[model samples]
Target: MYTLAVCAEMVFRDRPVPERAERIHEAGFEVEIWGWTRHDLDALARTPAHFSSMTGYIRGTLTDEDGAAELLRTAEQSVRAAEQLSCPRLNLHGTGLDDKGLPVVPVAGEADGPNWIAAHRTLTRIAELGESAGVVFTLENLNTAVDHPGVPFARAADTLALVAAVDRPGLRMNLDLYHAQIGEGNLIELVRRAHGLGLIGEIQIADVPGRCEPGTGEISYPAIARVLADLGYDGTVAMEAWASGDDDLALERFRSAFTL
Candidate 1:
Protein backbone atom coordinates (compact mmCIF):
# COMPACT_ATOMS: atom_id res chain seq x y z
CA MET A 1 0.00 0.00 0.00
CA TYR A 2 1.19 3.55 -0.75
CA THR A 3 1.60 6.00 2.10
CA LEU A 4 -0.59 9.11 2.07
CA ALA A 5 0.35 12.72 2.95
CA VAL A 6 -0.84 16.32 2.62
CA CYS A 7 0.94 19.58 1.93
CA ALA A 8 0.41 21.57 5.11
CA GLU A 9 1.40 24.76 3.36
CA MET A 10 -1.66 24.60 1.06
CA VAL A 11 -4.20 23.64 3.73
CA PHE A 12 -4.79 24.93 7.28
CA ARG A 13 -4.36 28.51 6.30
CA ASP A 14 -5.49 29.81 9.69
CA ARG A 15 -2.78 28.25 11.85
CA PRO A 16 0.97 28.33 12.16
CA VAL A 17 2.90 25.73 10.16
CA PRO A 18 3.70 23.65 13.24
CA GLU A 19 0.08 23.71 14.32
CA ARG A 20 -1.01 22.73 10.83
CA ALA A 21 1.41 19.85 10.88
CA GLU A 22 0.02 18.69 14.20
CA ARG A 23 -3.50 18.87 12.84
CA ILE A 24 -2.56 16.83 9.81
CA HIS A 25 -0.84 14.25 12.03
CA GLU A 26 -3.91 14.02 14.26
CA ALA A 27 -6.01 13.53 11.18
CA GLY A 28 -4.00 10.41 10.26
CA PHE A 29 -1.68 11.58 7.51
CA GLU A 30 1.93 12.61 7.12
CA VAL A 31 2.84 16.22 6.37
CA GLU A 32 4.73 18.01 3.57
CA ILE A 33 6.07 21.55 3.63
CA TRP A 34 7.54 24.14 1.30
CA GLY A 35 10.57 26.27 2.20
CA TRP A 36 12.03 25.29 5.55
CA THR A 37 13.67 28.67 6.07
CA ARG A 38 10.27 30.23 6.77
CA HIS A 39 9.34 27.89 9.64
CA ASP A 40 10.60 27.22 13.15
CA LEU A 41 12.31 23.84 12.96
CA ASP A 42 12.33 23.34 16.74
CA ALA A 43 8.60 23.87 16.94
CA LEU A 44 8.07 21.65 13.90
CA ALA A 45 10.28 18.98 15.43
CA ARG A 46 8.18 18.96 18.59
CA THR A 47 5.15 18.02 16.56
CA PRO A 48 4.45 14.32 15.93
CA ALA A 49 4.07 14.71 12.19
CA HIS A 50 6.43 12.73 9.99
CA PHE A 51 7.66 14.97 7.19
CA SER A 52 7.52 13.61 3.65
CA SER A 53 9.59 16.25 1.83
CA MET A 54 10.57 19.94 1.86
CA THR A 55 12.16 22.41 -0.55
CA GLY A 56 15.75 21.37 -1.06
CA TYR A 57 17.35 24.68 -1.95
CA ILE A 58 16.77 28.26 -0.88
CA ARG A 59 18.15 30.07 -3.97
CA GLY A 60 19.84 28.83 -7.16
CA THR A 61 19.32 27.84 -10.76
CA LEU A 62 20.37 24.52 -12.28
CA THR A 63 21.91 25.83 -15.51
CA ASP A 64 24.26 28.62 -14.46
CA GLU A 65 27.63 28.78 -12.72
CA ASP A 66 26.81 31.31 -10.00
CA GLY A 67 23.29 29.95 -9.52
CA ALA A 68 24.50 26.35 -9.34
CA ALA A 69 27.03 27.30 -6.67
CA GLU A 70 24.32 29.01 -4.65
CA LEU A 71 22.07 26.02 -5.15
CA LEU A 72 24.65 23.65 -3.76
CA ARG A 73 25.39 25.94 -0.83
CA THR A 74 21.75 26.21 0.19
CA ALA A 75 21.12 22.56 -0.57
CA GLU A 76 23.61 21.70 2.16
CA GLN A 77 21.68 23.97 4.51
CA SER A 78 18.41 22.28 3.50
CA VAL A 79 19.92 18.90 4.23
CA ARG A 80 20.64 19.97 7.79
CA ALA A 81 17.08 21.22 8.18
CA ALA A 82 15.82 17.89 6.86
CA GLU A 83 17.87 16.16 9.50
CA GLN A 84 16.19 18.28 12.15
CA LEU A 85 12.77 17.14 10.94
CA SER A 86 13.97 13.68 9.94
CA CYS A 87 12.68 14.29 6.43
CA PRO A 88 14.01 11.67 4.06
CA ARG A 89 13.42 13.49 0.79
CA LEU A 90 14.24 17.04 -0.35
CA ASN A 91 12.52 18.61 -3.40
CA LEU A 92 14.22 20.74 -6.08
CA HIS A 93 13.22 22.66 -9.20
CA GLY A 94 14.91 23.74 -12.41
CA THR A 95 15.58 27.11 -10.80
CA GLY A 96 14.80 29.21 -7.78
CA LEU A 97 11.20 30.39 -7.58
CA ASP A 98 10.31 33.77 -6.22
CA ASP A 99 7.59 34.43 -3.64
CA LYS A 100 4.97 34.43 -6.41
CA GLY A 101 6.11 30.99 -7.74
CA LEU A 102 7.56 32.49 -10.91
CA PRO A 103 11.01 31.56 -12.03
CA VAL A 104 13.66 33.99 -10.89
CA VAL A 105 15.49 33.56 -14.20
CA PRO A 106 13.03 32.70 -16.96
CA VAL A 107 14.13 30.95 -20.12
CA ALA A 108 12.54 31.91 -23.43
CA GLY A 109 12.04 28.40 -24.84
CA GLU A 110 13.29 24.85 -24.53
CA ALA A 111 16.71 24.53 -22.90
CA ASP A 112 19.53 24.52 -25.41
CA GLY A 113 22.41 22.04 -25.43
CA PRO A 114 24.63 24.16 -23.22
CA ASN A 115 21.82 24.56 -20.68
CA TRP A 116 21.31 20.80 -20.60
CA ILE A 117 24.99 20.17 -20.02
CA ALA A 118 25.15 22.69 -17.19
CA ALA A 119 22.00 21.28 -15.57
CA HIS A 120 23.34 17.74 -15.70
CA ARG A 121 26.61 18.78 -14.08
CA THR A 122 24.78 20.66 -11.35
CA LEU A 123 22.43 17.74 -10.64
CA THR A 124 25.37 15.36 -10.58
CA ARG A 125 26.91 17.45 -7.83
CA ILE A 126 23.54 17.58 -6.06
CA ALA A 127 23.42 13.79 -6.19
CA GLU A 128 26.81 13.59 -4.55
CA LEU A 129 25.61 15.98 -1.85
CA GLY A 130 22.52 13.85 -1.22
CA GLU A 131 24.60 10.70 -1.01
CA SER A 132 26.94 12.29 1.49
CA ALA A 133 24.04 13.71 3.52
CA GLY A 134 22.06 10.47 3.49
CA VAL A 135 18.94 11.95 1.95
CA VAL A 136 17.34 11.71 -1.49
CA PHE A 137 16.84 14.82 -3.63
CA THR A 138 13.84 14.95 -5.98
CA LEU A 139 13.54 17.16 -9.07
CA GLU A 140 9.89 18.22 -9.56
CA ASN A 141 8.06 18.86 -12.86
CA LEU A 142 6.07 22.06 -13.27
CA ASN A 143 3.75 23.22 -16.06
CA THR A 144 4.93 26.17 -18.13
CA ALA A 145 1.43 26.85 -19.51
CA VAL A 146 -0.11 27.80 -16.18
CA ASP A 147 1.72 27.88 -12.89
CA HIS A 148 5.43 28.04 -13.66
CA PRO A 149 6.16 29.48 -17.06
CA GLY A 150 9.71 30.02 -18.38
CA VAL A 151 11.17 27.39 -16.11
CA PRO A 152 13.55 25.07 -17.93
CA PHE A 153 13.14 21.32 -17.45
CA ALA A 154 9.62 22.00 -16.13
CA ARG A 155 8.06 19.15 -18.07
CA ALA A 156 7.84 15.68 -16.60
CA ALA A 157 9.61 14.23 -19.60
CA ASP A 158 12.46 16.67 -19.20
CA THR A 159 12.78 15.91 -15.52
CA LEU A 160 12.70 12.17 -16.22
CA ALA A 161 15.37 12.46 -18.84
CA LEU A 162 17.63 14.48 -16.57
CA VAL A 163 17.21 12.11 -13.67
CA ALA A 164 17.76 9.07 -15.87
CA ALA A 165 20.83 10.61 -17.38
CA VAL A 166 22.33 11.14 -13.97
CA ASP A 167 21.22 7.60 -13.01
CA ARG A 168 22.08 8.09 -9.36
CA PRO A 169 20.29 6.54 -6.41
CA GLY A 170 20.38 9.88 -4.61
CA LEU A 171 18.37 11.61 -7.35
CA ARG A 172 14.76 10.86 -8.40
CA MET A 173 11.66 12.46 -9.91
CA ASN A 174 8.95 14.20 -7.85
CA LEU A 175 6.35 13.33 -10.56
CA ASP A 176 3.55 15.84 -10.01
CA LEU A 177 0.50 14.65 -11.97
CA TYR A 178 -1.24 17.99 -11.82
CA HIS A 179 1.54 19.58 -13.88
CA ALA A 180 1.72 16.53 -16.15
CA GLN A 181 -2.00 16.76 -16.96
CA ILE A 182 -1.62 20.42 -17.80
CA GLY A 183 1.60 20.12 -19.84
CA GLU A 184 1.00 16.68 -21.35
CA GLY A 185 -1.85 14.17 -21.30
CA ASN A 186 -1.62 10.36 -21.11
CA LEU A 187 -1.20 10.28 -17.36
CA ILE A 188 -1.26 6.51 -16.99
CA GLU A 189 1.52 5.97 -19.46
CA LEU A 190 3.66 8.62 -17.79
CA VAL A 191 3.25 6.97 -14.41
CA ARG A 192 4.09 3.59 -15.90
CA ARG A 193 7.18 4.91 -17.62
CA ALA A 194 8.52 6.68 -14.52
CA HIS A 195 7.75 3.78 -12.22
CA GLY A 196 9.13 1.24 -14.66
CA LEU A 197 12.45 3.04 -14.49
CA GLY A 198 12.27 3.06 -10.67
CA LEU A 199 13.12 6.75 -10.68
CA ILE A 200 10.15 8.27 -8.84
CA GLY A 201 10.74 9.47 -5.29
CA GLU A 202 7.27 10.82 -4.60
CA ILE A 203 3.94 11.57 -6.34
CA GLN A 204 1.93 14.78 -5.90
CA ILE A 205 -1.72 15.25 -6.94
CA ALA A 206 -4.39 17.89 -7.32
CA ASP A 207 -7.50 18.21 -9.48
CA VAL A 208 -7.27 20.15 -12.73
CA PRO A 209 -8.82 23.64 -13.24
CA GLY A 210 -9.30 24.30 -9.51
CA ARG A 211 -6.16 22.70 -8.08
CA CYS A 212 -8.27 21.34 -5.26
CA GLU A 213 -8.73 17.98 -3.64
CA PRO A 214 -9.67 14.95 -5.70
CA GLY A 215 -13.22 14.46 -7.08
CA THR A 216 -13.59 18.23 -7.30
CA GLY A 217 -12.38 18.36 -10.91
CA GLU A 218 -11.43 16.24 -13.92
CA ILE A 219 -8.62 13.86 -12.96
CA SER A 220 -9.62 10.29 -12.08
CA TYR A 221 -7.36 9.85 -9.03
CA PRO A 222 -9.02 6.61 -7.98
CA ALA A 223 -8.14 5.04 -11.30
CA ILE A 224 -4.59 6.34 -10.94
CA ALA A 225 -4.53 4.93 -7.43
CA ARG A 226 -5.51 1.56 -8.83
CA VAL A 227 -2.71 1.77 -11.35
CA LEU A 228 -0.20 2.58 -8.63
CA ALA A 229 -1.39 -0.39 -6.65
CA ASP A 230 -1.14 -2.61 -9.70
CA LEU A 231 2.41 -1.50 -10.17
CA GLY A 232 3.11 -2.13 -6.46
CA TYR A 233 4.32 1.43 -5.94
CA ASP A 234 4.89 1.35 -2.20
CA GLY A 235 5.78 5.00 -1.92
CA THR A 236 4.30 8.31 -0.91
CA VAL A 237 1.31 9.93 -2.71
CA ALA A 238 0.78 13.41 -1.32
CA MET A 239 -2.13 15.84 -1.87
CA GLU A 240 -0.60 19.15 -2.79
CA ALA A 241 -3.89 20.96 -3.26
CA TRP A 242 -6.26 23.39 -1.61
CA ALA A 243 -9.51 22.47 0.07
CA SER A 244 -12.46 23.25 -2.14
CA GLY A 245 -14.64 23.20 0.96
CA ASP A 246 -13.87 22.39 4.58
CA ASP A 247 -10.32 21.27 5.12
CA ASP A 248 -11.28 18.10 6.92
CA LEU A 249 -13.79 17.22 4.28
CA ALA A 250 -11.20 17.93 1.62
CA LEU A 251 -8.75 15.61 3.34
CA GLU A 252 -11.40 12.94 3.54
CA ARG A 253 -12.08 13.29 -0.17
CA PHE A 254 -8.39 13.02 -0.87
CA ARG A 255 -8.11 9.89 1.25
CA SER A 256 -11.17 8.33 -0.32
CA ALA A 257 -9.84 8.89 -3.82
CA PHE A 258 -6.66 6.94 -3.03
CA THR A 259 -8.12 4.48 -0.52
CA LEU A 260 -7.74 1.43 -2.75
Candidate 2:
Protein backbone atom coordinates (compact mmCIF):
# COMPACT_ATOMS: atom_id res chain seq x y z
CA MET A 1 0.00 0.00 0.00
CA TYR A 2 1.09 3.57 -0.65
CA THR A 3 1.87 5.84 2.29
CA LEU A 4 -0.68 8.65 2.51
CA ALA A 5 -0.15 12.31 3.40
CA VAL A 6 -2.12 15.59 3.44
CA CYS A 7 -0.98 19.16 3.02
CA ALA A 8 -1.74 20.77 6.35
CA GLU A 9 -1.30 24.14 4.74
CA MET A 10 -4.51 23.62 2.78
CA VAL A 11 -6.86 22.16 5.38
CA PHE A 12 -8.07 23.35 8.79
CA ARG A 13 -7.85 26.98 7.79
CA ASP A 14 -9.45 28.07 11.03
CA ARG A 15 -6.71 26.62 13.20
CA PRO A 16 -3.00 27.13 13.65
CA VAL A 17 -0.65 25.25 11.32
CA PRO A 18 0.68 23.03 14.08
CA GLU A 19 -2.86 22.19 15.16
CA ARG A 20 -3.81 21.39 11.59
CA ALA A 21 -0.80 19.12 11.33
CA GLU A 22 -1.82 17.40 14.55
CA ARG A 23 -5.36 16.96 13.24
CA ILE A 24 -4.10 15.44 10.00
CA HIS A 25 -1.81 13.12 11.94
CA GLU A 26 -4.65 12.07 14.24
CA ALA A 27 -6.60 11.07 11.15
CA GLY A 28 -3.78 8.64 10.19
CA PHE A 29 -2.08 10.73 7.51
CA GLU A 30 1.35 12.22 7.32
CA VAL A 31 1.56 16.01 6.78
CA GLU A 32 3.07 18.29 4.10
CA ILE A 33 3.72 22.01 4.38
CA TRP A 34 4.86 24.85 2.14
CA GLY A 35 7.28 27.70 2.94
CA TRP A 36 8.60 26.69 6.32
CA THR A 37 9.85 30.25 6.84
CA ARG A 38 6.28 31.43 7.50
CA HIS A 39 5.68 28.94 10.32
CA ASP A 40 7.09 28.33 13.74
CA LEU A 41 9.45 25.41 13.17
CA ASP A 42 9.91 24.77 16.88
CA ALA A 43 6.17 24.43 17.36
CA LEU A 44 5.89 22.16 14.34
CA ALA A 45 8.70 20.04 15.70
CA ARG A 46 6.75 19.54 18.91
CA THR A 47 3.90 17.92 17.04
CA PRO A 48 3.88 14.15 16.62
CA ALA A 49 2.99 14.44 12.93
CA HIS A 50 5.52 13.04 10.49
CA PHE A 51 6.37 15.59 7.79
CA SER A 52 6.34 14.17 4.28
CA SER A 53 7.82 17.21 2.52
CA MET A 54 8.13 21.01 2.67
CA THR A 55 9.14 23.80 0.27
CA GLY A 56 12.87 23.39 -0.38
CA TYR A 57 13.70 27.07 -0.85
CA ILE A 58 12.37 30.46 0.16
CA ARG A 59 13.50 32.39 -2.94
CA GLY A 60 15.30 31.39 -6.15
CA THR A 61 14.96 30.32 -9.75
CA LEU A 62 16.46 27.31 -11.56
CA THR A 63 17.89 29.09 -14.62
CA ASP A 64 19.65 32.26 -13.49
CA GLU A 65 23.06 32.88 -12.00
CA ASP A 66 22.10 34.95 -8.94
CA GLY A 67 18.87 33.03 -8.48
CA ALA A 68 20.76 29.76 -8.56
CA ALA A 69 23.04 30.94 -5.79
CA GLU A 70 20.04 32.05 -3.75
CA LEU A 71 18.34 28.71 -4.32
CA LEU A 72 21.34 26.78 -3.04
CA ARG A 73 21.70 29.06 -0.02
CA THR A 74 18.08 28.74 1.09
CA ALA A 75 18.01 25.05 0.25
CA GLU A 76 20.67 24.51 2.86
CA GLN A 77 18.53 26.36 5.40
CA SER A 78 15.55 24.23 4.33
CA VAL A 79 17.58 21.10 4.93
CA ARG A 80 18.32 22.14 8.50
CA ALA A 81 14.62 22.84 9.05
CA ALA A 82 13.78 19.41 7.61
CA GLU A 83 16.10 17.85 10.15
CA GLN A 84 14.12 19.46 12.98
CA LEU A 85 10.98 17.68 11.78
CA SER A 86 12.73 14.55 10.55
CA CYS A 87 11.42 15.16 7.02
CA PRO A 88 13.32 13.19 4.41
CA ARG A 89 12.13 15.06 1.29
CA LEU A 90 12.25 18.74 0.40
CA ASN A 91 10.19 20.08 -2.54
CA LEU A 92 11.26 22.60 -5.24
CA HIS A 93 9.68 24.46 -8.11
CA GLY A 94 11.13 26.06 -11.25
CA THR A 95 11.01 29.43 -9.52
CA GLY A 96 9.81 31.15 -6.39
CA LEU A 97 6.08 31.83 -6.14
CA ASP A 98 4.46 34.87 -4.67
CA ASP A 99 1.55 35.02 -2.21
CA LYS A 100 -0.90 34.49 -5.10
CA GLY A 101 1.11 31.54 -6.52
CA LEU A 102 2.50 33.58 -9.43
CA PRO A 103 6.10 33.11 -10.34
CA VAL A 104 8.26 35.93 -9.02
CA VAL A 105 10.33 35.99 -12.19
CA PRO A 106 8.11 34.73 -14.95
CA VAL A 107 9.52 33.18 -18.12
CA ALA A 108 7.22 34.44 -20.89
CA GLY A 109 7.54 31.40 -23.14
CA GLU A 110 9.43 28.17 -23.66
CA ALA A 111 12.90 28.26 -22.14
CA ASP A 112 15.79 28.45 -24.59
CA GLY A 113 18.75 26.11 -24.81
CA PRO A 114 20.90 28.23 -22.53
CA ASN A 115 18.12 28.23 -19.93
CA TRP A 116 17.94 24.42 -20.03
CA ILE A 117 21.69 24.15 -19.64
CA ALA A 118 21.70 26.55 -16.71
CA ALA A 119 18.80 24.74 -15.05
CA HIS A 120 20.62 21.45 -15.32
CA ARG A 121 23.75 22.91 -13.77
CA THR A 122 21.73 24.46 -10.94
CA LEU A 123 19.93 21.18 -10.24
CA THR A 124 23.23 19.33 -10.27
CA ARG A 125 24.47 21.65 -7.55
CA ILE A 126 21.21 21.14 -5.64
CA ALA A 127 21.74 17.37 -5.87
CA GLU A 128 25.21 17.79 -4.43
CA LEU A 129 23.79 19.87 -1.59
CA GLY A 130 21.20 17.17 -0.86
CA GLU A 131 23.90 14.53 -0.86
CA SER A 132 25.86 16.40 1.78
CA ALA A 133 22.76 17.17 3.84
CA GLY A 134 21.37 13.62 3.94
CA VAL A 135 18.07 14.56 2.31
CA VAL A 136 16.37 14.29 -1.07
CA PHE A 137 15.13 17.28 -3.08
CA THR A 138 12.10 17.01 -5.35
CA LEU A 139 11.35 19.26 -8.35
CA GLU A 140 7.56 19.65 -8.62
CA ASN A 141 5.59 20.23 -11.84
CA LEU A 142 3.00 23.03 -11.99
CA ASN A 143 0.27 23.95 -14.47
CA THR A 144 1.02 27.17 -16.32
CA ALA A 145 -2.51 27.76 -17.62
CA VAL A 146 -4.14 28.01 -14.22
CA ASP A 147 -2.42 28.27 -10.88
CA HIS A 148 1.00 29.32 -12.15
CA PRO A 149 1.57 31.17 -15.39
CA GLY A 150 4.93 31.73 -17.06
CA VAL A 151 6.90 29.49 -14.77
CA PRO A 152 9.73 27.83 -16.67
CA PHE A 153 9.94 24.06 -16.71
CA ALA A 154 6.45 23.86 -15.21
CA ARG A 155 5.49 20.78 -17.16
CA ALA A 156 5.82 17.25 -15.78
CA ALA A 157 7.81 16.27 -18.83
CA ASP A 158 10.22 19.13 -18.22
CA THR A 159 10.63 18.26 -14.55
CA LEU A 160 11.15 14.58 -15.37
CA ALA A 161 13.76 15.45 -17.97
CA LEU A 162 15.69 17.69 -15.60
CA VAL A 163 15.63 15.14 -12.80
CA ALA A 164 16.54 12.26 -15.08
CA ALA A 165 19.42 14.25 -16.51
CA VAL A 166 20.76 14.80 -13.02
CA ASP A 167 20.15 11.09 -12.36
CA ARG A 168 21.24 11.19 -8.78
CA PRO A 169 19.77 9.64 -5.65
CA GLY A 170 19.51 13.08 -4.06
CA LEU A 171 17.33 14.57 -6.82
CA ARG A 172 13.89 13.35 -7.97
CA MET A 173 10.55 14.45 -9.39
CA ASN A 174 7.53 15.32 -7.23
CA LEU A 175 5.13 14.33 -10.07
CA ASP A 176 1.95 16.13 -9.06
CA LEU A 177 -1.10 14.60 -10.78
CA TYR A 178 -3.43 17.58 -10.47
CA HIS A 179 -1.07 19.76 -12.45
CA ALA A 180 -0.48 16.92 -14.90
CA GLN A 181 -4.23 16.60 -15.44
CA ILE A 182 -4.42 20.27 -16.28
CA GLY A 183 -1.15 20.71 -18.18
CA GLU A 184 -1.01 17.26 -19.82
CA GLY A 185 -4.07 15.03 -19.64
CA ASN A 186 -2.48 11.61 -20.06
CA LEU A 187 -2.08 10.92 -16.34
CA ILE A 188 -1.49 7.17 -16.41
CA GLU A 189 1.08 7.34 -19.16
CA LEU A 190 2.89 10.16 -17.39
CA VAL A 191 3.06 8.11 -14.22
CA ARG A 192 4.35 5.14 -16.17
CA ARG A 193 7.01 7.20 -17.91
CA ALA A 194 8.23 8.85 -14.72
CA HIS A 195 8.19 5.59 -12.79
CA GLY A 196 9.88 3.75 -15.65
CA LEU A 197 12.70 6.29 -15.48
CA GLY A 198 13.04 5.73 -11.71
CA LEU A 199 12.70 9.49 -11.18
CA ILE A 200 9.76 9.87 -8.83
CA GLY A 201 10.57 11.08 -5.35
CA GLU A 202 6.95 11.64 -4.31
CA ILE A 203 3.47 12.06 -5.83
CA GLN A 204 0.98 14.84 -5.00
CA ILE A 205 -2.68 14.93 -6.00
CA ALA A 206 -5.79 17.10 -6.14
CA ASP A 207 -8.81 17.04 -8.41
CA VAL A 208 -8.87 19.57 -11.25
CA PRO A 209 -11.35 22.45 -11.90
CA GLY A 210 -11.53 23.19 -8.17
CA ARG A 211 -8.32 21.91 -6.64
CA CYS A 212 -10.44 20.04 -4.12
CA GLU A 213 -9.94 16.59 -2.67
CA PRO A 214 -10.53 13.51 -4.82
CA GLY A 215 -14.13 12.58 -5.81
CA THR A 216 -15.04 16.26 -5.98
CA GLY A 217 -13.75 16.65 -9.54
CA GLU A 218 -13.23 14.84 -12.85
CA ILE A 219 -10.19 12.66 -12.12
CA SER A 220 -10.75 9.01 -11.23
CA TYR A 221 -8.19 8.73 -8.45
CA PRO A 222 -9.05 5.15 -7.63
CA ALA A 223 -7.95 4.13 -11.10
CA ILE A 224 -4.71 6.01 -10.57
CA ALA A 225 -4.39 4.21 -7.25
CA ARG A 226 -4.67 0.89 -9.04
CA VAL A 227 -2.07 1.98 -11.53
CA LEU A 228 0.35 2.93 -8.77
CA ALA A 229 -0.22 -0.45 -7.19
CA ASP A 230 0.62 -2.17 -10.44
CA LEU A 231 3.68 -0.02 -10.86
CA GLY A 232 4.77 -0.98 -7.33
CA TYR A 233 5.16 2.66 -6.37
CA ASP A 234 5.41 2.28 -2.62
CA GLY A 235 5.97 5.97 -2.00
CA THR A 236 4.18 8.92 -0.46
CA VAL A 237 0.91 10.06 -2.07
CA ALA A 238 -0.04 13.47 -0.64
CA MET A 239 -3.30 15.38 -1.05
CA GLU A 240 -2.44 19.01 -1.67
CA ALA A 241 -6.04 20.12 -1.99
CA TRP A 242 -8.65 22.27 -0.31
CA ALA A 243 -11.65 20.90 1.52
CA SER A 244 -14.74 21.08 -0.73
CA GLY A 245 -16.98 21.32 2.30
CA ASP A 246 -15.97 19.61 5.51
CA ASP A 247 -12.23 19.03 5.89
CA ASP A 248 -12.72 15.66 7.51
CA LEU A 249 -15.00 14.52 4.72
CA ALA A 250 -12.50 15.71 2.15
CA LEU A 251 -9.72 13.74 3.80
CA GLU A 252 -11.96 10.67 4.01
CA ARG A 253 -12.75 11.02 0.32
CA PHE A 254 -9.06 11.35 -0.47
CA ARG A 255 -8.26 8.26 1.59
CA SER A 256 -11.07 6.27 -0.02
CA ALA A 257 -9.92 7.17 -3.52
CA PHE A 258 -6.48 5.68 -2.87
CA THR A 259 -7.35 2.92 -0.36
CA LEU A 260 -7.82 0.19 -3.00
Best by lDDT: 1
Global lDDT scores for all candidate models: 0.97, 0.95
Report the lDDT tens digits of candidate 1 across residue range 1-260: 99999999999899999999999999999999999999999999999999999999999999989999999999999999999999999999999999988999999989999999999999999999999999999999999999999999999999999999999989999999999999997999999999999999999999998899999989999999999999999999999999998999999999999997
| True lDDT of residue 171, candidate 2 | 99
In model 2, the worst 10-residue window by lDDT is: 1-10
Q: Write the per-residue lDDT of candidate 2 for residues 6-94, one digit (tens) a residue.
A: 99999999999999999999999999999999999999999999999999999999988999999999999999999999999999999
Residue 218's C-alpha lDDT in candidate 2? 94
TM-score of each: 0.99, 0.99
Model 2 residue 31 CA deviation in Å: 0.4
Cα RMSD for candidate 2?
0.6
